[model samples]
Target: MSKKHKSEHHEEHADESWLIPYADLLTLLLALFIVLFAMSTTDSKKFEEMSKAFNIAFNSGSGVLDNTTIVTTGEQMSKERENNRQPSKEDLTKEQLQAAMKQEQEDLEKLKKQIDNYIKTAGLTTQLETKLNQSQLMITISDNALFPSGSAQIKPEARSLALTIATMLNKYPGYEIVVSGHTDNEPISTAEFESNWDLSSSRAIRFMDILLSSKKLDPKLFSAIGYGEYRPVDSNANALGRSKNRRVEVSIIRKFTDPDKSQNIPATPK
Candidate 1:
């Protein structure tokens, strides 16, 4: 009887051994649920990347999906549309060029009126000419009007010119001012300048200092450079051309946007 009872007890426990496989099935089902929950919560952009990687791992040539996941498409068909997207390298370079030109355009018109009025009032229009172009607003001051030959010093009368420009600049708050000095190709050897290069650069720096000296402006927004007859407005062949080239150029930093504000790079293009 004791042997038989022991045998029956052993048989009952033998059927219970299937619990191990049952527990394993439950574990696998729980893991599947967790994975599905994680997939549901992932970010769309990151999910797109992950999907692509998985597809590649599976050795599928076709991409995960066609334009199903993306950020934007760049197109500028109108002006009112806010271009608040990140621009591509080509788009960015082109935007910089366009902004530079457009910014110059508005500046030219305003500068024209202001300069014409000043010239008319102060009787210095012919001697001090304002020129407008695609990239710069140039106020040309004859040596007789602004400085002595080879000297960076601004004449007393030239103070009005600086003040007027500064006032105009104050009206437009977000522009960088670039003052560039150009010199005639003729060699300049003097105490003031080791060569035309020095003279040109010094003249640019000196004039820029006059602008930053204004308490209203920030020093960070101004730049000075010397072109030393390289970017002459006309041929070095004549006195008139050289005179035009020998003047100072004041450039207003144009606005529209930088690449950070206007460009959007999408991952699918790659």
Candidate 2:
């Protein structure tokens, strides 16, 4: 009877070890829900603290969630993507303008070199000069090189030189060309020209006409201006300085310029 009673008590309390592991599973599931709830909130500092505690409880600091990036909402992800997107149209246009300006500068430099080489080869260095600046490329020719003393007409021999210049200029089209004439302060009253202004104006017009003779050169892009004795490059008190003042300038104006560099250049009178 005593042995029978002991066997029944053992059967009644059989396999209680399974309940220990079941309780541990329930506790792990509850911890997982708590971690999920914390992540759903915007309190990052608390989430980090909770993550650390969980690491210590489950993985001893080395865990799958270690070094995890903070969870972000859909809108936040979209905003981040927009911030890292490609350049805008305005940015592309600015880059294109910079590239175009660089190309134009190179073209102008090459044209200047070619003209300089021609002047050297022709032994006309004293009568001709080329200068490239921020605004334009100026080719200056002495008045004596193209005309008789106090005359508006270009010499027959100078026609060939003008033709060559026109040929060179034809290689670079679509640029605004200004043919400006300047004279000494010496007063002039001739049968054909009433004043220095008349002479200078006629001279500029005649030279520009020759430049326009080239079919390849656009007449619409050319202009003639005469400053008379006003825009002298040197003092008019001496004969040599007066001679230097009598000249014609062919200026090829730039279409585009770098704003930063253009600001440093002094404004030259037209």
User: Which candidate gets the maximum lDDT versus the true structure?
Assistant: 2
* Model 2 / residue 153 / CA error / Å: 1.0
- Candidate 2 residues lying further than 4 Å off, grouped into runs, are 1-92, 262-270
Stretches of candidate 1 above 4 Å error?
Answer: 1-108, 257-270
Find the 10 residues in a row with the least total lDDT in model 2: 61-70
- Output the worst ten-in-a-row residue range by lDDT, candidate 1: 70-79
Residue-wise C-alpha lDDT for candidate 1, range 1-270, written one tens digit per residue: 999999988887545778766765554454344334436743454445444444442353333233232222112212223454444335547757566545545555676678778878998866777765433456666655667887888888787787787877777765667888888898878876889888888888877877777778877888899888687877788888777678887776444433544432221221
Residue 96 Cα positional deviation in candidate 2, in Å, after optimal superposition: 1.3
TM-scores for the candidates: 0.54, 0.63
| Per-residue alpha-carbon lDDT of candidate 2 for residues 170-213, written as tens digits (9 for 90 to 100) | 89887899999999999999899888899898999999999889
Among these predictions, the greatest TM-score belongs to: 2
